[model samples]
Target: MTPVTYATALYRNLLRLNGLGYLFRNVSIGMTDHGDVRNRGFLLKIKCDSVTVLRNVRQKFKTLNLKDKSVARIFCRTLHGSTQNEHNNNIHDIDYITFTNCDNDTCKILRNELLLLPNFVSEEEEKQVVLEVEPYLKRLRYESSHWDDAIHQYRETEKLKWSEKNAIIIQRIRDVAFPQGVKQISFVHVLDLKKEGFIKPHVDAVKFCGNTVAGLSLLSSSVMRFVNTDNKAQFFDVLLERRSLYIMKDTARYKYTHEILKDEESVFKGKHIPRDRRIAVICRNEP
Candidate 1:
């Protein structure tokens, strides 16, 4: 049998073993075999609505002991594209605050200080921002090693200049989030997180930045968890959707430690939040 045919058979058998044979009706699988047998490669694509089933399939794939044993890249696409716009519109009008058994006082404090605004920028503006800063990010190496042990598997750069259009967007964020008398930091920070990257729980150094830090989410969605510093039991999760803006100020910035959870641990409202590549544009106030 040809290599493509063999791969198709192998995939089907594995799915059946995992009790996911029913996915065959919803999933479309195709393969492209390179010319040489020894150097041949193939691509597998699966489309399904269930994140739980996708996680199970991924776990099963990880059990495969191939000759190379290299990691397989999985890309997820939402089936409902038309509802995305409506979803953005709805989130834009609402403020989402979730707490885990925290006291009413603490929850009220967080609710007042933490703000998440979805669809803060249009799709075209997000694209423009990415296009402007991607070249700088590409030049920098991924910061896997750090002295402070704060971040993991990310690339970051500070940009002082922005295009005229981008500058207007930045100013809007500043006017909305930060107070007028405070001195804004001169440069904007661009951070790119890998698919498997995460930010450990830590507060921003007081000496480096002031009470307010505003960030614009791009590319992917993620969950930012806030843990009370004095009492670890008091914590909450904020869902940061793409094209959304999050502002942490006063109590939310100083009283709590914030971190971006890894994909495996990224669950909000009992649903798994799969993270691909995420880019955040962060702006801060001078200390």
Candidate 2:
């Protein structure tokens, strides 16, 4: 779980207990006034007798704010139950999908594993693949019905037969990246994009595809935002770099709808990354 998630969950539980008269209410976050640096970490001094509750709260605090420098040292103190707790409103309720960034340690570990490899293709390989796929871009038709006229030309290939090198890459992905019980994936959908091309938020039809979908991003970097179509408040963004591989399974695939903005950039970790002409080779197992 991310720091934001841990903090949000702890805040939720505290609110629940406060409602039941179990917790001293008005929770406030502030810094310490201690003299020495040794005794200077933020304190959560709640007047409570429940040892389990205290332990859980401290653990959550440690995970949520200790590592990230941008987060504040929140000292939660409970006041009378009648007091309105403004501190509780710090985090928005987020539950549409699970996300992990490329910078995360867990994601780094997983990238080395079989299930989710990030930069599976080399830069040279990406260039070659782009060259091979460029010829089919001419066959693309303008999709005026779905998107704005300025940003909607795309070519979705019919069932494709891979070349010798492409077939080898697929075999390797299957052997290492795919989990057991997954059927073989035979075809790929190559979507060629125009300069300002983008697709709006939508989920793939489960009737035609499997639970797991693997995509290889080539030629450009872009930001794809996954939004909860129902709530609209809960959403997450992921940066898709050239030569990277991404996997969407279970909740990420079925619950959240993904979209890319036309003529836009995504801000991630305080850096603004621009979008470019991207080719997404989407591979899905038969359901």
Candidate 3:
């Protein structure tokens, strides 16, 4: 049989399985040659909402008969929440913060002393910064051993030096995002997230970092959500576009718990915003 026909048959078989019809409807199936003329393979990519669903699907998938069993593979991924619909139901009461411009006064609607600067750096400048920091990023691991339990599926490093041109860029960021009189830390923190990585809601440790936290987003866009620690129903989602910078201080920094949602749960203004590998250059003042 042709590859397409085989793939269709496999998809049909999965859909016909009892108790999993709803899940099979969302499964993505395809066939690939892996750029090799001799080898052909069938790939089944399953996105499940919970670990229980994934376990059930895997056990069922194993029971299916395959013409070429050696070449058939099933890959299952469980996102933080299974589907966008599930996420919407949970966040129906949360508020969203839209970006108008870089003006601090206009962006303060979300919280006091919170600001987002869109396109903080030009494309060329972003490339230069990425090139300068690429060495530090290379050493990152898929899972970071941070003391905080809130971070997951992330790689992070701290650097104290930069090239002359990159140093100027950092200084420019400090001038724009940070308070002038405050003593900023010399080292910069780099946090890289895998496509499926996410940050759970948590406040930054006051002992390790100070009142202000500024970050420059790179590689991909994501929604940074802030929820009031005292009020669970009160929250805001801030879209952090690529190359944009965000600063949080005072009430926004201390009174709100911040988190980065997983790709499946990343929605802003009622639209799904798919996420990919993301890197951020973070700067903070002395504690």
Candidate 4:
């Protein structure tokens, strides 16, 4: 639980950026120190001991025409078809679609999660992973050859904790998941491969502010392909390079389907590059 130092009566209004909603109770409208964070106390009562407020917020969100489907449609068109560094032959997919790469004329509503997960990796563990993770990833490549067309994951439920570094990341992710008094949580370390070493077109089922967020910490070299499910599945690839952190939210998580290519032998400008094992830590939140 976070020690809230906020006060109520400072909230101006509420807004939705990427389909996730927040309880923006007042905190900065020149309120008094009330001996503690008023916003936290207010949120404590508003979100309450149950998820009723959460459900209500979601229902009202649908009426505003800000549902996931509507957001996903706009997400697809904003891409204007593909990104830079994407290969013509590599198929791709995305779980969360963002308007990060849109034209200047577009609106930019960067939703600020009052609950921002500031730190990703712990200090000592960060050093440890930096030193040893590469070797493990090297081993993983050969090991991956034995598995095909599957997703591998770990737990973030109330059952166990990962390495100390992972445990730290897990806790922060947990804050995002059970921001309210949630019931259950499940975390995983997942990797979806290209059956032939490349993925076909597909959509992801990771939800944020609702179910799960694929908190990806890239450990190897790979590309994620994004395509519009309603269209011809025309695509683009995103490079999940070494040590990158990606957070796919909202419609991007469920709409605008995506996949990792499984192309092992193909004509990519008449060149051939063997596919390597791709590894990701897939943490989940369930309630």
lDDT per residue as tens, model 1, 132-190? 98888888788884468988999988888889878877875675456435698989888
TM-score of each: 0.66, 0.56, 0.62, 0.43
Between prediction 1 and prediction 3, the one with superior TM-score is 1
Name the runs in model 1 displaced over 4 angstroms: 1-95
Clashing pairs in 3: 49-82
lDDT of each: 0.67, 0.51, 0.63, 0.35
| TM-score of structure candidate 3 | 0.62
Error of 1 at 41 (Å): 52
Superposed by TM-score, candidate 4 places the C-alpha of residue 171 at a distance from the truth, in angstroms, of 1.8
- Residue 217 in candidate 1, Cα distance off native in Å: 0.6
Tens digits of per-residue lDDT for model 2, 103-214: 2332222222112234556566677676677777666674544433323655567446667666655554443334434685577777766557787778887787876677
Candidate 1 is scored at a TM of 0.66
* Winner by lDDT between candidate 4 and candidate 1: 1
Give stretches of model 2 more than 4 Å off.
1-116, 145-151
Task: Give the Cα error of residue 180 in candidate 4, in Å.
Answer: 4.1
Candidate 4 lDDT over residue span 1-287, tens digit each: 11121212111112222233343431222222233221221122234222554454333322222212222222232122222112332212222222333322211111221111212333444455434344443344433332333332211112254576455544544443332344444635444343345554555433433443545444344445555455543433354434334444444445545555444532232343334544455554452
lDDT of 3 by residue, 1-287 (tens): 35544444334333322224355555655555443222322344445555565554444333322213322221110011122223243422223354322233323323235555566666777899888877767875689534677878888888788887678667756654453356888899988888889999999988888888989999899999888787766677887888877878777888889999999999888898889989899999889
Alpha carbon lDDT at 259, candidate 1: 95
Error of 2 at 184 (Å): 3.8
Error of 1 at 45 (Å): 53
